[model samples]
Target: MINSDEILKKLAIESNIRQEEIPDIDLYMDQVIQLFDSKFMKSLRNEEEKVLTKTMINNYAKGKLFIPIKNKKYSKEHIMLISMIYQLKGALSINDIKAILAPVNERIEKENFDLESFYSTLIELQQKNINNITDQIKIQEHEIEMLENDDQLKQILFISALSNMSNAFRKAAEILVDDLLENNKKKGDK
Candidate 1:
């Protein structure tokens, strides 16, 4: 059986690119790829998994997932947005991500948005939530351990419970995304 402590430690060690880690200057596509690879490689399940490829970056640019780049280079805000898209991709479709980030992109273009402060706040909130998540995991582990089942069965049950929770969260996120898109469309029509 996998220990809860081990799971918590793994969660703690998972990569989260701090605001300070991002370079102040704009980066070329190749440099962006290298940065992502270095920061996210440990989070990948296998060594063969690519973090961000040129094609993916190009597609994101074409798809308007982030603001347009200049001189074939990406800025700090671009990297932050790409990192957000990468995380959201695990639970949301690319279209969903685009819809959700539309307002943020618009703000960046139209207003003097403080993306650095926003990103820093987001990272701090995420770090704070880890304790809450680990607590939930510990509670779930205790519940699973109480059941009189074989070790394999217990593991399966634990995974199934986690999957159900993940599905619920994903559905909620999708609903919120839909609502935001609908509201945006309404505002556009006005």
Candidate 2:
């Protein structure tokens, strides 16, 4: 049997970038790329995978996902926002991410929002979800073990359960993004 404890440990390690790890001063583009590469090295599927590139950063700027850069350097807040974009890109379109982050970006521009504190709260919530997911995995494994001696069926069922859960969460996120966009439109119209 696979080691569930090891999987849980790996998940916890690979899934987070603590707020303190971010550099306090601004970084050049290359430095930003290097930071993400080092932090997310284990999460990469292959050695050749690039975590962040100059083009991607430029494109994100063009998309207005965050405030404009200053003097060819990225601030700590910019790095945090880019990290969020990296996480969301796998499951959401760029438009969807833009829609979701629009209000936050506005606050950062107009109100000097404390992104560090907001990111800390997000990390706490993520840790809670990780614990919940690990518990769910254990339950699923126990149920799989109780089934009849059909290895193929067990594997299929386990994968299906995970896929279903992913689909549900992705759909929920899409729905929320749509609602946010609608509300923003209504406010603009008023």
Candidate 3:
């Protein structure tokens, strides 16, 4: 039997996947390939073209489609799986692909083949991402509030000063007009 490391190295070279990208290559070789080559992966691609790029591989890994083998690195199974996903990207969303790969990843990660328990963790992870997004929104809202309040204060102060200047100008113009009218009347009478 070919060793797991050899399989992973081969997969890396063939699929353009980096060795470092396959997180846990040493411990579980069979499960790694199995997760990658699941029925979902196969259905996603055409049989003739089967290699994937580093981006696809990383997406799959992060999406929970494939668990990194613990110790061994490369294998034909991993290559075939990536090939399948590459084929699928044409029609599938990253989230859709992740959903399809979820069960397979769960099984591999557990090493025991049970899937029921892993769903809980997946939900938790999703919730955590949501919380993080919400927190960022809250911080942005607070910053906007501060900026808006400061702008309003500045506008109020500016308007008050402008109004006072306008009133003074109006009073001065009225007094000047009255003085000119009185002098004209006196000259007419004389």
Error of 1 at 133 (Å): 1.8
What value does the lDDT take at residue 104 in candidate 1? 91
- Candidate 1 at residue 49, lDDT? 80
Candidate 3, 121: how far from true, in Å? 28
Best by lDDT: 1
lDDT pick, better of 1 and 2: 1
Query: Cα-based RMSD of the predictions, in order?
Result: 1.5, 1.9, 32.1
lDDT of 1: 0.88
Model 1 over residues 1-190: C-alpha lDDT tens digits?
8878877765544578889999999999999999998887776766788989999999999999999999999999999999888878989999999998888999999999998898889888878877787887888889999984688888888889888988998999999999999998999999
1-190, model 3: which lDDT tens digit per residue? 2222432343332322233334453324454444454423433335675333345555676665656633445443344345445534544556555555554655655667543334335435545654554454344444444555566664454445445654675566456545655665687799
- Please estimate how well model 3 matches the true structure, expressed as its whole-model Cα lDDT: 0.48
Q: Between which residue pairs do clashes occur in model 2?
A: none
Cα displacement (angstroms), candidate 3, residue 131, comes to 48
Give each model's clash number.
0, 0, 18
| Model 2, runs deviating above 4 Å | 1-3, 6-14
Better of 2 and 3 by TM-score: 2
